[model samples]
Target: MNSTAKNCAALAKRLTDSGLRPTPQREVVFKVILEKRDHPTADEIFARVKSQMPTISLATVYNCLETLVQCGLVRQVNLERAPTRYCPNLHEHAHFHDDATGQVHDINLPADTLKQLRSLLPPGFDASTVELAFRGSKGSARAKLAEGRAAARSGAN
Candidate 1:
């Protein structure tokens, strides 16, 4: 099977395994989450899904999100004082939030770094999960262009 088909099958299996029925709404919601790895809020997801499935209701979307998160098919990224975002990345990683654009970027940590982080825990303290987040300004397209121009001028010196 192709990657898309494989992904769909995996999601369906997850729902089935989690004791949840993989309804059409749930499938579409899962697809939206996977298609846009931008970690969108529930409202953003509802808008996208509405385009595809105009009959879908916001309440239904919210319910679908809850079911997906409960099934481990999606992760809810809760930022302090911000709306929750849904993520489908099931790997161990950190998130960098661009305060300027309100975007979240996933950062894959090196195994060594993960090991060091775990080593910081006190003895006999078993930690199964870790959530690391960072906030900073992600340079804009205009800023990047200006930086490139500066580099070109400096190189010509």
Candidate 2:
């Protein structure tokens, strides 16, 4: 099966395992996040779902999203301006938050990078998860910062 189908199946299995009743509203909310590439907030999701499920209340969507989050089927992209964004990509990765357009993009970091980073940690420290955010106006802030810092050091030398 394709990744999308697998994701949908996985989500269904999760809901079944979590003992959360699979109501129509819950299914719609799950599908909206699972299908969309753009990470949407709960309000955005409610607006989209309200078209087909006009009777479905906003509170229902909020509760369903929360339930999905708790079940680990959806990851919450918490930001200051937005209520909370949801992502179907559950793999280990970082996120980039655009300050100008307020977009959130997934960033995949190399495993060696994470390993090398952990090597520099103080003794007796154990790392579980690594989360890094590249925040900027429009461009890649992380790359820019690294390049700028490298240039500054070279110029000083």
Candidate 3:
């Protein structure tokens, strides 16, 4: 079978195993995540899915997303108090969050660094989960704005 078919089958199996009722709406959500690489937020996802599944409700999208997250098929990220974002990438990687544009990108860290960090932790502190996010504004616009703010603060001081 082709990659898309394989992904769909895998998602269906996962949902079934997780005791989630496999509905058409949920399947479409999974397909969107598998096809789109943007790592969309809930709103973004709802908009895209609605174009195809016109009858699908926003609440249904949210519920499907929550169910997918619970089934360990999707990762929900809340970067710096912004709206939560959903990612289909299951591997371990850091994230770069652009505060101005609200975009998130994945950054892979070295395995050795992860192991070393886990080793230095205190006893009884198991490092099963690792999430790192760098938040900043991208491009010259944000840079100029930040510089202006800094200048104003220094002048005030």
Which lDDT tens digits does candidate 2 get at residues 39-124?
Answer: 99889999989987899888898899889889987888873555777899877778888888988898897788878888888999
TM-score to true structure, per model:
0.50, 0.47, 0.50
Ranking of predictions according to lDDT: 1, 3, 2
For candidate 3, the 10 contiguous residues with the lowest summed lDDT are: 75-84
As for candidate 1, its clashing pairs are none
Q: How large an RMSD does model 3 have?
A: 15.3
- Candidate 3 segments whose C-alpha is farther than 4 A from its true place: 79-157
Give Cα distance to truth, residue 59, candidate 1, Å: 0.7
Question: Lowest summed lDDT over 10 consecutive residues: which window, candidate 2?
Answer: 76-85
Number of colliding residue pairs in model 1: 0
TM-score, predicted candidate 2 vs. hidden true structure = 0.47
1-157: candidate 1 lDDT, tens digit per residue: 9876787898889988887787889888988899979999999999999999999999999999989878777888873678888899987889999988889999998778988999999999988987789988887789999989998989955
Pick out the ten consecutive residues of candidate 1 with the lowest summed lDDT. Answer: 72-81
lDDT of each: 0.88, 0.82, 0.83
> How far is each candidate from the true structure, as Cα RMSD in Å?
17.5, 16.2, 15.3
